[model samples]
Target chain A: MEPPDDAIPDRPARETLAHLRARIAPAEAASGPVLPLGAPPLDQRLPGGGLALGAPHEIAPEDVGDEAAALGFLLALLARRLAEGPGEALLVLAPGHPLPYGHGLLALGLDPGRLLFLEAGDDVEVFRALEAALQAGSLPAVAGLVAEGLPLVAGRRLQRAGAGTLLLILRPAGAGRPNGAATRWRIAAAPAARDGAANPRPRWRARLERCRNGRTGDWLMEWDGGAHRFDLPHGLAGRAPAAGGTPA
Target chain B: MPVALAAAGPGGLRLTAVDAGARALGLRPGEPLGRVRARVGSPLRILPAEPAADAAALERLCLWAQRYTPRVAPFGPGEDAFGLHLDVTGACHLHGGEAGLLDDLERRLAAGGIPARLALADTPGAAYALARFGAAARSHVPPGGTAAALAELPVAALRCDAATVIALKRLGLKRIGALARAPRAPLARRFGAALMMRLDQALGLRPEPLAPIPETARYGAARSFLDPVSRQETIVAVARALMGQIAPRLAAHGLGALALRLSLHRVDGAVKALDLGLASPGRCPDRVAGLLRLRLDRLGAALDAGFGFESIRLDVTAADRMPEAQGMLGAGPAEDGIADGTAALAEALGQRLGRPLLRLGGVASHLPERADRILPWRPGTGPAWSPAPLPPRPVLLLARSEPAEEVLALAPEGPPRRFRWRARLHRVAHAEGPERIAAEWWRADGPARDYYAVECEAGRRLWLYRSGPHAAERPAAWFVHGVFA
Candidate 1:
């Protein structure tokens, strides 16, 4: 159910080419500050080498059941963010999310002590804290999980402070629309290599919904957890999409 | 008006020591019982006054006044009569002014069914004079006005011994005004250093400080509302304001508060108190507010702000010698410090949830369930969590181990071939080890356990343990302890 490539959104307003270019360019955020996704095709498409450090990156599950896959994707990004910025802490703005399993996060190479939970009352405070942390440029990354989609205003406001710190906003699957993010990605859970196995590494069909200066395409990302990085599924490397899952 | 403590002297319980009350009644202390009996004695129905009980009451009154300033005690020793001395240098402004402080103190004491006279001055000697004999129940002398305030007071108001006063009267110095211009050399020669010392103390030439009880907080701040606040929000606001006031005082002391007591004086005469114990010492407004929020969350709906709180007091019960830890370098504070703003979130979450946010970490004990217990995840907390060199444990652990029924095995001593837990039989597809776990002998009378990690056909891993040794007795009991993800 992807919209036509050039189809205009309902609230079309005046937008300049320079402003649009600035969105993709990420001048200050670019300076080689991103944590590369490791996939050559995705890395090649992303401007500033990879995901912007101080920019809010929105990620949504492709389907309702792909939460685990989306979570794995987010964790991989966070692990990469932490690795790139050593000795820096990761602030998670999950007000009431279930306790993060220590072993699972440990498997992703995250030290349990390095992760801190921030409980905010509402969406406004969540973004406020995220933006403040981003502007402070203290922590390596500030990520929040909001079940409901954030309004464009809040997302855009967060973008202003996204210079030296990374803002990763995890919204629920099927709950994302275009906003002022530098990049937008949709991830869904793929079938495990072994069916009904205990604690198998999750797979994902990660679709690049929008990119500021990068091309939008679909890629299969699998959690190489112990290795602590995301990789293309065994059979798909620089290849077209296989016909099984539908893209949201 | 003051409440006097009268007891039997040489006379049979006449007005032994009259306060403002007997004085206002035109009655003097040490008056003869015969004259009182001839007057309105029979109708008086007087009860003997106990000095110890009166002193205890005065002590309690001082404790009540502590809500205004931490330094509260008897104005002077027994020579100073029954009066309260409050070292409210910085605290009086909170009630408004010296006059405002007197008004609030009078209102609260009157509301509590007690009579009191209050006087504020630059010197304790002046304040003592004004409180007992200032011609008004309440007297507050502005700064630099102590001389004028003391000039009109009689020599008896100087807090000197009775013999000194009688001796001073013989010199025709009946009023402090008459003695104000006297040459100190002549006065000292005639009346001795004691009399001169009393005059100098009363005139603010020498220091006359009160010795407050030791428990008093050097740093304290309070707010007395013109109207009582019944709502929780208003009370919380008042608490924040007091915190604001106290934080600076803590800073001036070159310290931080590790523990604070917020005492709320309810309009209904009940005092509700909340004591906060911070894991770390800090004076940051947000950090203090966050910790307070955590404490307030504990009360939730149980915090009945009945009638309303007439006053809010914040006393730093315990202070830390070191200043609060902050982010010194741009690299920011390490996770353990939690001082550079990151620590408050962890504390806030821990406090709001009323428990630690992390899962059950392992303890050193060998007891199966007791080995791992849920502890709050504080910044600088519990044992460090390092990944085991061996196989990892399960993420989910059962609150209590449930007994497995109809367990089938080749031998009673060996790991189960198949076990039924919660009516579901799990066939062992793969088996791990029989790790022996024992409980502390002195701690509890507990059976030892042989723990085994077995995987079921459905790929679900289970931690099953057998109680007691095998062979001799009836088959040992098998229970499923935890399920691994």
Candidate 2:
């Protein structure tokens, strides 16, 4: 059912170049600034990846740490984002899970000023808020903690609602089965690095099992507290391919 | 009109409705306004309630109180009235004793033109009672002596409202100590358990825990000067002093904060707080201060330097404890910190451009571009925060969707050669079509769309579509929607 020969799109004219330029220019121009992914390997796998300004991505459940660790991850991310520039804020939608709100976010780096909190008594309100935030573009990111095996259609609807918006759906990790998603990552607290390694850095094991743009693969990222950066495992670049082989 | 700001000092903000002429007419504290108004006539001025101003005032007070402890909480909202919670468990001894802290709070409050009652007790409830009811020298209640200390305060000090006080008075239970000796069953039956709980909390007979607040941040530091200092250099210097303490803690924990909070306590008892965030978590003092300047500007008027600020504290509500293990750093190799820099810049810009204006375009498997979300930078990371595919995608998306002008086609469900958008006729130069996307049946009246990717003479491609009624109904019609590059 290919189009008839006469209907085939002609090789685009140079004049088309002007149009292409006009189209591509804004995408590039709108690029006010991009926050780095804090991890090089993770950044390479993304489309202009880095922490997309005004765009947020989700950190999966497995990516969450032990109660305390998850709290730390959330706070650090929030603090980092807030510190990035003005109008940056942290919004948390905690559903099902009992988030010790006072302990978790406050301890992490939530500024009483930049933080807007909504405690959804149930999943419905949480989802509604997620949709509202996306449509309203009120906040840069919205985090929703959902039950495992939730329907994919609903997830798609939320994604559609947040078109250009980053929605993080926190679900239990390794539940082992596909729940439609553009990109899925798993993170865990790596064992402390062997002592005596020259100025050993703190690291976390992250596996980018799924991505919308391309495959990001498994990575061991070390976070440098003072410098505030995440570096990949040594010599691993030689082993791991940078991008997805084909859109999996 | 001058705004008279009054706070409970070490407690919280409390409002006393005062009129210019009504005071002369003999309206007294605790006197019902209606009765006074009837006596004073229509000429008496009525003061409107100002919760926003009150909350703002309390926010300032909390900044000042932070000098005494880190976890200073305002009492009226979730706790008791006109009081604040200072978890001085380990900090009191530094002030010499609980008595000293109380005395210091009183002196500071008076110096700020706010007269305050003082109290120090084993529990929050007891302290609340002592602060409200204990006279000058009678403020401190030693451990295990809560009952004896609360024995003289009236039932009203139990934090009950006027109605409840009247009920207690009618029942001959005028004193909190008297209520404590009464039978528990009758007390619960008459006033419900609240009265009993307050009594028990005051006596330390029940465990009354303070609800801790979560800030989603880590590693914060603050400093309070004995005298208010208005100089920007002084504020930055204090911020540096605090950051110096916070930096090592962050490094030791292998964590960094994305946000920093700077609170300035003015000498007039007015408090102001400024928040700064980083694009990434790093311990750079210069970077933190740079971001804070934006927030300071937002507080322009309310942030009056006054005589100057008496204190400043920086707090980190979020942090990460990484297992130290470094590797090489490069553009793509060190992704974590790189984006952090941009995030910092965005945070600063967000303040000026207005936060909602910043947005990232995420991929959505739907026709409507508006359905896609625009998110802020600092929300939590959850599942589905990333993009996922369901079907047809437009390369160029219009900021706002416009209706299609025509739906003529070569085949029944094919792409159109020409269409009008926003009242302009666009001759199709090339086209792709019939990417069918059925509406979710489980959803409420969702529409089914058969989308087309059409490139017009202008070389602009669009994601236009025809919306059909549910399969249960006859087929539907078309519309021009998103744009594609």
Candidate 3:
């Protein structure tokens, strides 16, 4: 039946509606599922209440010297992902990148036995291994340390291949290029809350710079190495960013 | 110009081998090189003899001759005679007949620029004598004709030593026919049982077994092309087809391939080989083909398909027993598929990169570097990962410690308050104790290290260590060993 002209949307309008629906679909249906970061404020701000599984995410240090901080954040996420499932995790180390200390990984709650490391000669090989690992969909998570940002096409390929898996791309700061990632984070080392504690937990100023179908915000996060979880500083929890952060 | 290989003997240099050009000029092997130079009024090319290289080449030829017959052995237990003996009893039928096999062998050897004298007889001794002393370059003795075949050959054709040959010549037994007719008891007593045994072996009275070279791989498949192929797709397809041929053989033996070697025989005799290792034993043709494709893609120009490849061979270099798959009654297939998928991915990546995927393991070592090890990843093979009650460790460890510059410490051997690393200055805001770790006395690696966990004002944490105590000759040096998040 013929309806009013306004009611019968035009071609461009229909396309726009479809695109909006694509963005609003449940993350579980679009990807696989959501992995809650276990932080209430952060989860409340995220669209799916957590990081989406089976999608690509980009993480980098805010400064060149803070690479260890970025790697620590990635390891925290990897440890959580491995704990959630029974499969192994693959870590592809690019050329010139140092090997992750076994004791350090153990101290951070990531089992060294559950991780496989592939040291690639260059960025090309690094991407090749990353794509292969993602496509296999055998591991629960896969991460690669790249010297520079990946091209858009390669990032999209990784995104497509990483269905039902967590794909993390770790690169140096200031090498950011446009990519098809679910979330983009920049981590920087932050001062410990306690001045003279015997062993202070690592603190990172994690900023969610970009997210698809969600909002972005900056927050000071602390990693509990003993428990392998992210935590808000004792007194700063109330001052953390709320769920009303600017939407992307 | 004539050429000869000379070796330093007891008195002087003597010719070990002479080419046809030198042989025609009456310069035979075992002649003194000085005498030959003084006698021959022409330019001569003399080079040192390489017996080792000759033996290696002969062994390779023996392996190469396996294409014609599996039973191929190098001529041995005698003087260094550069030749091979092949027993093509039942294998000759595959190449049409004995004549056809010899023709094919001769053609291939000549194509490879190898000058060969060929003969086919009933026994190894008969074949050896006929090939070395026969009038024709190629000879074929009919069945039941071994005695007649050796009748006209010289006594030396029996492969006897020089002394025995000279002694036989003095006894008027120059021909094998004359030796066979001589009184057996007297001949045996004079030349010992060895001479009589050689005659009997040649005449087929005694059985002689040929010890062929051992096959390196039990299962292999090979194909030759009329036109050399340089395209990657063709090579992959051929590899897949060859895998298909080998898969059944592996399954029949309840075995799976752990490693495979692909040899591409180029037109110029240079073989380009690619080796592939699997995370677990596997015999899937598609998986193998996929790995080959990945490797070929990575090789790209490095493969150097110079002038193309004429023959390709796939060999199962390593194999292991593969138990039959028994799926659980209620378990989902997806569970099993995941493990298979991971193995397939590892194989692909490892083959393409020419490296194995490794897993981090811990050793019972006090030294940090020695405490951690990386080994090839295998299922259920490494020690279980358990957190130890140890001091804080850094996430990233440098391959080697780099010295810190402009180090300023509060105490003589305490943590540094300020230091420059990689041109970046860091001011220590807080610090931990100096964990004294002595070197292993047995190893005598170096001086003991006093490690510290230092936090900079900028919030960057670094692991620093002092090499040794302050000394007059060698001052205590500080180096950054790792970085903490």
Candidate 4:
């Protein structure tokens, strides 16, 4: 009986995109990559069709000590992509952090006016505001510091809101996967590279540990103390590190 | 005849001068008085010009005409040829008819002992011409028929001086009718457009605008009675009539008044003003009347209604609109909770102690003493708070600090270990370092204070500071600057 055709191992649960696209206009369905995080290669695979579009991508946050550096680096990449396209705003919901140090974000080329810092008194209000912004289609991206289990249904609802919403959730390590999150990214601090000088400024690296549709590997990086940009660490390109480091 | 009232001297009785005999003796405005004396000899008591009395009479006339229309504008200064322009557009019908209204006005003027002539016409020029040149001589023009009536009057009707009239007479334009017949180009080129404009205005081809007099301010309404209304119920009825005028007008303009000025137009023409202010802008007449009654009760005389008020006018001098904002989807500060709390506190205090006794504290500049102030219940505005670097601030602020004495271990850089407030001694437990803040040195009398953040054993945190240097030549005193909770 042809080994029961319904049991084909490779078939999708359903043709989700064809039916969903029918509901959404073709113009919206054919939109290009989410504003690329100005990071190379990751933008090439998104079907909407850029970097992760519309929902919060879980970012395993570095501890409080590395908060400023990590946020600065993430914002710099986001600002660069936003600057390349028609202007987009990045709303940062700093529920309890020290204002994300406005000077640092401004130094990273994010126009101060475009960076909206809402002091949401608590974690719940901040998340509600984030979800509201996504549903209203008012925000292009919402970056928040989440440190708990996100309700699976809430995550899905936020993703289905609109197309260009990139919710970058900076969660702490071991918070587990953001329930129902499409793509998950982990940013960790790597050792500074050996410059010609004996003592170099402290530098850190970020790796895309578990991308949903792409291979998961560590991307060796270095941070410049001034001119705040990350570049390919010396020579490593398309090559994964031979050994894995301790989990952040 | 021009009857002049003159006060001869401080000791003399008022004298009346009759110019009737002089007019019978062929006297004009510019003719010398000696010739008038030669013609009419005795019984003509001549008094020098009494400019003040003449002006007072003209002002009284202006006030009287306000009973007919609010916009009665008096013409000329110094009591010379004092004419008033009353814009009786829709009001003519109220006094029966235009002719009836004019006759009534003339009778009232004569009764008031004012020698005045009036002309009712479509344009100001025609009216002026009819009043000065055509009154008691020519047929009066029908209302709104300015052209046919003013056609035969002389060109002098254009308000031109003697020189311009003489110039026009020399140009063969003795009659206004002759000039109205001439070609526009020749008329404009020969005499100038101003001459033609006045001609056109008198003939109804062009409009002449007249400014109205200022209306007596009556923010809320009240009706006068022939009988003095001491009854609260009657006063309330009049107040309701006023609110009927107020609420609809405010609603039409999307406004609500925060304060209302209710003036009772007394029978004797004296106004008694009652001012009422609310916790917030409001439109409900009953609520406004409730607030107004508190003030009206203090009037010196019972609201007299000798002859009911001739009119009532409501002016919205102060108002506000509840602004609509776009963002946020939740209900506002609960009306019953926050709104009622603020309103009740204000209303209770306002009703019991009278209006000006309670007020909100206002913040001013950083000059220590002037930083916080209390402004009375009046419309006062404060400067915007600019983001400037201020001294380490307390979480809670006090209106006026209580007097206290302090003892410090170190002279300049230490917190107080013991402080005496209101003659009671308290010991400090944990203390924060001296937050060095200097007085604004630009001022003449500046207090140099060294602030200290000290927590007492009783768990009270006080912002205590010492004024003047510890080792200064002058004595140092401790001031309990502020208390923080």
Candidate 5:
């Protein structure tokens, strides 16, 4: 008779909303600490003004050839985390994967002495070591390079085990499956800016493909090794580039 | 069938040992095999004697004999007979009494198909003499009766050489009783101090130390169960309890275990030993238990608990002096906390992976590949990370360089303008350097490598090098060594 007054709602609607919010409050609070990139634009875009620690993060190259770029991005993040504390970082390499050069890691502001390299026997062992290391919580950050995609159960386990540490999973491009990762990044090598110098700084087109509780965007990031910080190229300093465009 | 083992002797092939069938046929050791073959006029199984294998088996038996007493030594191949010496001074009570222990030892050895003569006595020398030439297979000599027990045995039973035995017999001192009654001065003067020393040792006059096998473990604890345990949890729990028993002894000695050995003694006398290596020397039972748990989990189905394990023993095979805990007055909690956590993690990972956690160490070498090495991670024991001013290195270095094909260069000695690597063609848009690195003169690693950092048009950077110099007879070979960010 009253045209099914569902739009007006009833007393139970308020209680349902409160219950949903109550369920989400503990999860948001349990995300643990935040590690800021020290860049205002990037940090502001993140939900907590930084990457959420104690959660799993997925990173993959945009193409097979861009693997080095993806690794560089992950190492940069690891370096930032190491700088924030006095603990070591572990890099677990799947079987048959090449090791990252020590001098290169040093150049990226990561101390080779502070990094532990564990070459796992297979993809399964890689995940096993990653989960164990994360649960140990002795390290500031743990990163693994796997050849296969992460299964859903493993992803959840990793998320659960990595409380109080940063967990990074690096896989090949297009190998990502549904997981509970807080953020998924796609990294691709970008052409160096022509600054009339013989050696230009390395650059990458880092795209935040997915963020669980934050907005996603794309940016051209330049690694300033001397300062140990990410910088925008000289020409694109203040302007926020348009989102969802082909990488230049 | 008659079975005899033959070994090459100075005169000819001689039998080293004989089985029961061969013995019944009147075949004896030290007899010529050819003579036996000609006289037997029947089929006899003659096998080559492996002295080395026999020694190894005897050594393993000595290790197995450790079940009875920690002080067990292998005696052999010399003037003395091949056998084991167990100093069961205080260990005799563990298996009832002396007679019971001897019985159990004989029964077990018999079950293993090993024909062994067991004896218990006050001294190792007396025990050896009784076991070798005694009338019974198993004999027990009462304390203070060593002289009486060894009296009936021949003088050769004192482990003297053949020449000494013959000399004594020529003097009509054939029996130990006769030798002991003879003039001590003449015997000591004629036969030297060794013969008298052996006699005195057997009579308990002189202390004869049994040089037990070099035990790897200094401290150990064992637990036996009435009902065998096969479940993984039970085994881990037993291992933890054993470790708990051993930790206090280790602490009492101010030692920490660097390596541990967990031996699961099955009901069938088979032992399954698992070794765990610690990253840092520690005596904490909980950490040891955690590592053992991980190791057992990794073993999973491979851990064959045949008829279950009746006893579990934990041994600290390798240990180091552990400093006493310093007062927490001036220590930083952050550093200590991290170090402890790291050590625990390393132990877990190491036990699970069956390898040690490694960290990269920089080496003072010009070769890129030889510049860094992965060494086992040890706290406060690696090179400090200092960034050296050097050329830009690649982020990922291939274990082996791959050859590049379809190379097109604008200049003969310049970087290639276009190249194909792994079946993919790449066009170089920007290039830097001919960073010439010469091979070490002391090394024979071919010619120098002129490395170039090339950025391909597809936005991928690569590290390429040309081996040797360009010549008319041999064109320089191009190789892709690494990838860059």
Candidate 6:
């Protein structure tokens, strides 16, 4: 027996099989953690209790005045996703050359150097550029500011190409038409109650228009730019706006 | 085959050019038109010569010759029979060898229905002489073969003046070899210094300075085909290959192109060019090709493949230093601000769309226009950190300031209470302070401005400014500068 084992006795066949199984078996599927939407009510409405990662999300502004809110939401979300891994980059595709200011991005806790900007003349070019950036797979996410009407084919391509990234398409506020997206949201500026402060903190009204197998909800979202997060309340303090919101 | 071109002479029309066919009939340029007409009679074809049209055609050919070398230059002005000089010292090697290059040049010109004679030598003078009067007409004189090659040729090969050649001939010095053996003192005394300089330059004993054309592109790659190709796929394939050859050089220098020009040398002698610019500099060939594909799609009817392109050249006309990406070592991407692959995306988009697209960084300045500047993000040159406090500016500024019509201030000089912009009237619901920005003295002299951030009743934030003073000799002019989101 000593000659057969050299130094020790062979383990039981059953135990050896179990140990080998532990070492070679595939690890759990990549559903590590859900990205918390931060707004307690918004998270509570979704079955997953948070926004899904590796999915395409749409953030559209209600009008010219709501553009800032939609953009701010995208920036904060991108900043958070990019911060997960060191040196992650974000591609920003916009219409025309009216690019976001470096100082403004810096205020949003994003390094201007990390942002690559491109101008798309139309929706076709926008989707073409977005598809390429996603296929490259080097960036944690790509943000596009385009007027919607994206074909379903483009939406499907984005989903397949974006594996561990966030594909955010920001368009002007319009009808919540189907576009093969995993989630669609409408965002607008929510003016805060006037206080004595020179600059009151900015807030937004985020409404979930469509979610694939997920609950639809609305909330008054306040962004904490410094932390690159929204102030998540405990016990779901974010109640739907008084206006006719998503059906409970 | 005799052909002679007649031009106006002092004694009426005379022959300016004679082809071999005309020369066989004892006709040549400089012969009086009446004499040529008497000599050839009715068989000779006499046509008026147009110097202007010939010069224009030669100029066009010179531009087309740029594919061979950017060092092409015209030997003479728009007068006489003009010749093009191409400094192909370093360029010929790409076409295999000097002989190979000359053959290619001749074949291409012949196909274009233009007669050509070419020669290559260490000196431009020798090359010019060999091509013009050598027995072979087209020759390539080896580096040390200049003296031997030019010796047996006629003294006319020395590029001397007509009078000087006649003088040398009268002295029985018909051949350059005989002239070289003549008494140096008397030769200099009689022939003058110009003859000696020409001889020296042709023999490579003296430096012949050549002025090369200014090339905007420092980096280029060219490919010539054994057979002409017309298919769009073939042209695109060649273009992609040329780009592949050029990118390594750019990468070695740590540079990326801001703009590229793709020149297609058609078999019919026409050159078609496509320009692709980059929003941000990058060294990726695939991205460049992608952009070019988009541009080609947009070109549609504009880009006709034509008989086919015999050669394709890719030139990096404008470029900026683009260092290697981050995460090469362990220093994570967070350390490097701009993300990897962003430049590639920008370049691809710029090619598909027209023009370069970039973000503007506001510089702390007094002038509103000067304050908003297009900041360049590259190595060595970085955005200077300014701790100086500044007033808030708008995200989007109008390309040019448009005058605001019908401006009524709340209290004459106070913030605008109501104004009309772009044919729409906006009522001011809230108003901020008047931030005065003085005009730049060094720049153009313009009236001072008082800017105000006004919130309109429709919830649009407008950055309006009043030019000059409200109490000035004339009423101040109002303009809408930008809109804040």
DockQ, model 2, C-alpha based: 0.02
Give the per-residue lDDT digits (tens) of candidate 5, residues B1-485: 78999999969999999999999999899999789989896779999999899889988988898999988888843435668898888998999888889889988999999988887888888888888899998888988888888888999889888999999999998899989999999889999999999899878889987789857645888888999999988888887788778777877887788889888999999999999988777777777778888998999889999899998888888888776665467862211112467777777888898756788888877778888887887766456755653567887778889999988999989999999999999999988878988757788787889999899997788999999788998688999988887
Clashes of 2: 120
**Across residues A64-149, which tens digit of lDDT does each residue of candidate 1 receive?**
54554566677677777777755344444444344344544554565555665555655665665566556556567778777566
lDDT of 1: 0.68
Which of the CAPRI classes, incorrect, acceptable, medium or high, describes model 2? incorrect
Quality class of the docking in candidate 4, CAPRI style: incorrect
Error of 2 at B17 (Å): 33
lDDT by residue for model 4 (B230-252), tens = 45555656676777777766666
Question: Top lDDT: which candidate number?
Answer: 3
lDDT of 6 by residue, B1-485 (tens): 45678989889999888777788888868899987777678877777899899878877787788889878877742112468788897898888888888888998998998877788888887777777777785888877898788888888877777898899899999988787787888889887898988888878888977765546546899999888887666667777787788887887888877778988898889999898876566656665677678788667778887777888888998888776776656765221113435455545455555534354455666765665456543322234434322345554567678899788886878898998988889888877768887876776677778888777765556679998786657678999887654
| Interface RMSD score of candidate 5 | 1.9
Judging by TM-score, tell me the better candidate of 1 and 2: 1
Off by over 4 Å in 5: A1-10, A29-31, A193-199, A237-248, B1-80, B83-214, B327-339
Ranked candidates (DockQ, high to low): 5, 3, 6, 1, 2, 4
Runs with alpha carbons beyond 4 Å of true place in candidate 6: A1-39, A43-55, A68-97, A100-115, A174-176, A192-198, A232-237, A241-248, B1-72, B75-77, B81-271, B274-303, B306-340, B375-391, B398-434, B440-481
- Give me the iRMSD of candidate 2, please: 19.9
Better of 3 and 5 by DockQ: 5
Tens digit of per-residue lDDT, candidate 3, span A97-127: 7779998888677888888899898888888
Q: Write down the TM-score for model 4.
A: 0.34
Give a tens-digit lDDT track for model 5, residues A55-151: 7888999888788899999999898888887888898998756778888787677788888888888888988999899888788899988888677
Best by DockQ: 5
Q: Which of candidates 2 and 4 reaches a greater lDDT?
A: 2
Better of 1 and 4 by DockQ: 1
- What is the fnat of candidate 6? 0.18
Counting clashing residue pairs in each candidate, in order, gives 5, 120, 0, 10, 0, 9
